[model samples]
Target chain A: MSQGPVRKILLFVDGSEECITAAQYAVVLARTLGAELAALYVVNVSVLNELFKARIFIKMEQMDYEHDLEQDGRRYLNYISELGRAKGVSIETHIEKGVVNEVVVEKARILGADLLAMGELEPIKSRSDAFHDESELILRKAHCSVLVVKDADYIERLYQAME
Target chain B: MRISGLLSEKTISRLTRTDKQGVIEELLDLAMNSGQVHDREEALRAILAREALMSTGLEKGIAVPHAKTRAVSEITMALGVSEGGVDFHSADGKPSYIFFFLLAPENAAGPNVQVLAQIARLTHDRSFCEDLRKAESPAGMLAVINDAE
Candidate 1:
């Protein structure tokens, strides 16, 4: 008998605080559908320039705490891997040095992933309520189905239900 | 402003004060130091109060927690480099690196969108994030950001 199309999930990570939100969603989806998780990080190599002078921007008494936005990506991927291992889910990670949306979508296509999970870059503070939201701009433009997660709670709901 | 609006390189950790209280304190400090905010405590409370409503953590090792304030005359930004990443409670479950502690007057919405779009443009580049991590010093990090702009 013929089988349905395979459902692979692609996650875009940027070492931003929001990645945590993206991972939560991807992890639950991976566990439920028994799909594989592919984590990818796009490394931007242009932060080391001189004209920008945007580095070493802060410190505590001459100590170098230059942000390690890239190194932390590996650490995060490890965390995702651990979460997957514990859940008995298959997980894979890819770190590419390029643009964020382009590399993420490209990686997903190369892997034939069906879904893309990502977090917001910034949040909007309004009088009504503060919104933790990602740009629907990228989501709408993505080739595959995009699941933009605003809250980390959605993942918890899945875990609670699964349990 | 060559082009991009990222902040000073990563630091050992300024918001050394962890927790929600600490984050609010640091954000207040940033907004004030930015000269855009008139009152540190007020701005801090504003940002923290917003966070209490919902965490700004976006998931993927980044968080953009901010608040609206009448104190700020224009949109101002600050960079909080955390050595010991905080538990921002991001959706993906990771810490933050490049924090854009944004503050603007309650009235201006255009500048807010302009800055957000700029931030999005920066993240859109992966090599930029890679270079950000590779940077060992503040100058190195700034150099990368400048070139990207």
Candidate 2:
């Protein structure tokens, strides 16, 4: 049974290798569906805080890292836009600062996206890892239809065919 | 894009200027040497205008003074390290040590934003900042950036 037409798609990008494959697939899907695409990169503040708490990261001098992370997010979002451009699809880019999963879900809702796309996640090493896995959390929290793009080889072929 | 890729020893300098305006002009001259900027005066005016609106002096001894103008053909950047620290009217009221002078073509908004962000992220590292501060020469500064990248 079809849920409905997918007019808008929101893609979550993290600059991971897997996200590149996901981006290719997202571009292809958006092109095929004639859907408006928006790519978002969230600066995971919670992860930064976790590193700070664990002493893995030195104390932030004055929350300047947040601005840095925002810029980092823009860089990642720009990459997604490039991917979309290569496929002859136009993608709007957005950056947000927050817990990654929450931000992704909220953006999907706010965009009224019919579909949300993201990279394939790594295998959870343990139950705790699964519990904290951002992709898993996003899958649970997203109100729109979620698409996890795997099969990198096939997606690469699909993206290249668009050229 | 990586800031390291856009930077060269010729575009990196140990700034002798003690004031913000002098340091910015010094850096802009270095950027012009890269041959990416065609109109030096236009770029200077754009940067100063941006400064007039609000200081780009960020806290923690970092300042990125940037502008978009037709003067630059692409996203060009110059790195300056000031040992004496120049007052930029930063948010913390602290003098800024590292100066990233960026100029981009008016149309290249995407790469310009990405480059600015890359600079911010790299400078945010305390060790990176410390290493940059200690760089003795233009070549030394390039090496620090190379190692960081």
Per-candidate TM equals 0.44, 0.58
**Superposing all C-alpha atoms, what RMSD in Å does each candidate have to the true structure?**
16.8, 9.3
Candidate 1 wrong stretches, greater than 4 Å: A1-6, A46-67, A124-137, A160-163, B1-149
**What is the interface RMSD, in angstroms, for predicted model 2?**
12.7
Tell me the lDDT of model 1 at B14.
46
Q: Which regions of candidate 2 fall more than 4 Å away from where they truly are?
A: A1-163
* C-alpha lDDT score of every prediction, in listed order: 0.59, 0.80
- Per model, state how many residue pairs clash: 60, 0
lDDT of 2 at A16: 71
The TM-score each candidate achieves on chain A is 0.71, 0.88
Over B60-136, each residue of candidate 2 has an lDDT whose tens digit, in order, gives 99888877788978889999999889998886899999988888776554355456645655776899999999989
Candidate 2, lDDT over the whole model: 0.80
